[model samples]
Target: MRTAAPYASDPSRVRGRLFAEDESAFRSPFQRDRDRIIHASAFRRLKHKTQVFVEHEGDSFRTRLTHTIEVAQVARTIAGVLGLNGELTEAVALAHDLGHTPFGHTGEDALEALMQPYGGFDHNAQALKIVTSLERHYAEWDGLNLTWECLEGIAKHNGPVTGALPFALAEYSARHDLELHTHASAEAQVAALSDDIAYNNHDLHDGLRAGLFSDDDICVLPIVGAAYEQVDRLYPGLEAKRRRHEALRRVFGVMVEDVIDTSRGLLEGLGSVEEVRGLGAPCVQFSPALWGDLKVIRKFLFTQMYRAPSVVEMRKQVTAVVEGLFPLYMERPDLLPTEWAKDVDAATTDIARARLVADYIAGMTDRFALAQAEVLL
Candidate 1:
């Protein structure tokens, strides 16, 4: 089905014209955003990045690429059901994690520390940089100069009003001064919520596979476990894949329904719907109700998955590896990859040096980082 009229404006500022190359074909603005993201180089790098474990650890676990694809799937379904822009949702979902470092959160933490003085490391903002100014593949420009909508989706991929500080900044003073942050557009808000849904639901599945947690342990969670039980009762003796898929679908259906029902009220009542429409483009977000749900889920993930002992243990090693490498690389700039040498010498201060260090580290995959650390060790 054709996507709804874009909830946001075309980035090009051309009124009444589609973002597509030719409007005669009737392509939607969000579709154009999705296509551009798919063709970008950053999207492909996800395959090598960690989701839970290193990608090569096992065939069953989700890699960053798989996780991204799954988020897109869930986001698209939610968008379609809610009369939102599926294309824009898909675009945001696909690109949301592109700036994530190679080893997943571990890499992010390391970069955050290393870049602490420069500005700080924020994966979402970095993803924006990748598409807009960092990716070298676009010879004609510094970056893709994607639509404001796409940029918003990526920036707020965690959804609007996260009540969280900006993940990073361009300079340390911005952070130290506790500066007020600008909000990301609504489209990014949807992507952010979708990301939460994808990880919370799917990580349970991945956690089971990695021996980090058991299905029985997972089943104890509030609604999710109950949802799993309902699926088992409904489909007795079904094939494993069938059962798991059915279970996932059921859970997703619940979450999506909750988001739609919740968001519609906020959009209609809280004035965001009219508010966003007035912005001149297509974007979507968590209704007030969904935002409440987000807090609940965040608590659960923190208590259950994120703080799990296994994950914590692995984090230590990751912190050590990345932290150890930073000073070494900085002291002997010669240790950096050839591409970074120019940036190294040109850097006028420690923050710039840290960013260069992070650039080198962020570009590495899980194994490459380990390998490099070993050489330094």
Candidate 2:
């Protein structure tokens, strides 16, 4: 194991869970958190959730679960290199997308729009709900009862929360403050950046595989073209598959190395995790040059992949599915599973009922959602 950097999140000194339990004899607290996340029903549901492509669209396209695993792998790599807490990073990465609605951002957008009157839907906030209250597998607790460090990482991974907070997050923080006004620990920052790296790299690969764009087309982008040129120079007659993999791996390497080198310098003078949070900015990030290049690549992807004609059409279809389902559930809470009856009965206000309806709908998988639409809407 790498010796932790001075500023790394130290699991030994971690803030305890809301519902206290004896520390595991065999596992670090963060390791136990990672295990709990892996075993969560929300994690399994990720397999059938969509990103750019719907679940049944194709076998080769990335599902939410696969994308999450890739994020965890990248997070672990970056966290390991930075001497941060790898287990906590991996837990955050694995749990980051837990609240994403089925059918990718399309579904989330539709849900958000439909939910506008009821304090809006933010995936980050919903993820907080899932961990702190939604999942109910334990005999002693309703949720995973993760440590404050993991919860803080999840809540503030993107950065300091400001303005009006989402309802779910605000509701939780009312009971146990996540310190929403400050940056999360360095491990969480690594997890957040890893999310960016994973999506950008794999979105390109999936776009190519989906026939939305070609390797030739991507080579027109900044870092991609240089990578392709390097691959060609190294192996003049390399086959297309091998060549593409080599080039993209180079692209991936450039990002990882840039983040490590850039962050190492930023973390140089920090002496503790509190200093990491109080620095008033992220310590982990891509270099400015690489970030600019990534922006160009992201724009290309926005047009050629995420907003391609076929994808847009699918988006419309999924949007309708979410739109149709939310109102139906609101009109008919009895349609919610028997398991949800207690909460449904307890929810007295319109806002509470709307949020409850949204919760059930958000927890759905792509196929299950479509099936519900087919049957009810």
Candidate 3:
């Protein structure tokens, strides 16, 4: 591996895990964290979790797991170019979406609405809960017991946290503060930007594949238009599939290169990871020009894809699933799986039970929730 930047998160001086354990003989803490996340049941469930489209909508549509892999790929590339710790960046990227509910953001919105009175639901916070408490496969610990830096990245890779914290995050922070008010490491920052890059690029590809928009429609857009023009000039008669792939691949490259160049300048002289965080702003960013273009792209997607009629209809359907399931479990805690009975019985308050129910629902996959809704609701 390349020498990490001075501002990079150094696993050598990691803040350590919540529970005490011996260090690994073979892997860095960040690598260990990444492996744990990959091996996690939550991570596997991402395969059936929704991205923009429901998981069952199409075989080729990007699911949460595939989207996460793309984000990690972009993150590793950016972190490597910037001399950040690639493993930590990739780890953060891989774990970033672990908290998303089934059926994409729609499911989250539904559950969030139901959970509003119970301190509300946030995928980021739910991800923290998953890593910190939900996955109970360990012999000595309930969750993965990841290192502090890994948990910090998972908690707030987007930037600092302020205002009201999500209930799970607030609860965890009470025991072990995640320093919700400050920025995360430069590597974590890279992971955040990588998510933007992956989704922006892939959503366009997925949208086109789903026939929500056309190549001509996007050919008039900024960066993508230029890419198509470039492709046309070089491979004038390229097949549609190849052309789309080639153009999007270039679009992806542009975003990646922009981040590396922009952040390299921003982080050039930073002497430590603390400096990166205390810098009080994100160092990893797209150029203003690209960011503006992405907004246009995102706007186009919001109208032409995300809010497309078919997607909207599916969203409504999934929303009902989450909505129905939350109350059912709350009103009939006996409906939960046998394993959850112990926790359900232990939940002494309405708020506690509500949050517990949210945890159970949030961990569901698209099909499982649908199946459960069919049988129970």
Badly placed stretches (over 4 Å) of model 2 are none
lDDT of each: 0.67, 0.92, 0.91
Give per-model TM-scores: 0.81, 0.98, 0.99
lDDT by residue (51-79, candidate 3, tens digit) is 99988889999999999999999899888
- How many clashes in each candidate? 11, 0, 0
In model 1, the runs with Cα more than 4 Å from the true position are 1-30, 159-185, 237-245, 269-274, 277-304
| TM-score of model 2 (CA atoms) | 0.98
Show the colliding residue pairs in model 3. Answer: none
Stretches of candidate 3 exceeding 4 Å from the true structure = none
lDDT of 1 at 37: 81
| lDDT ranking, high to low | 2, 3, 1
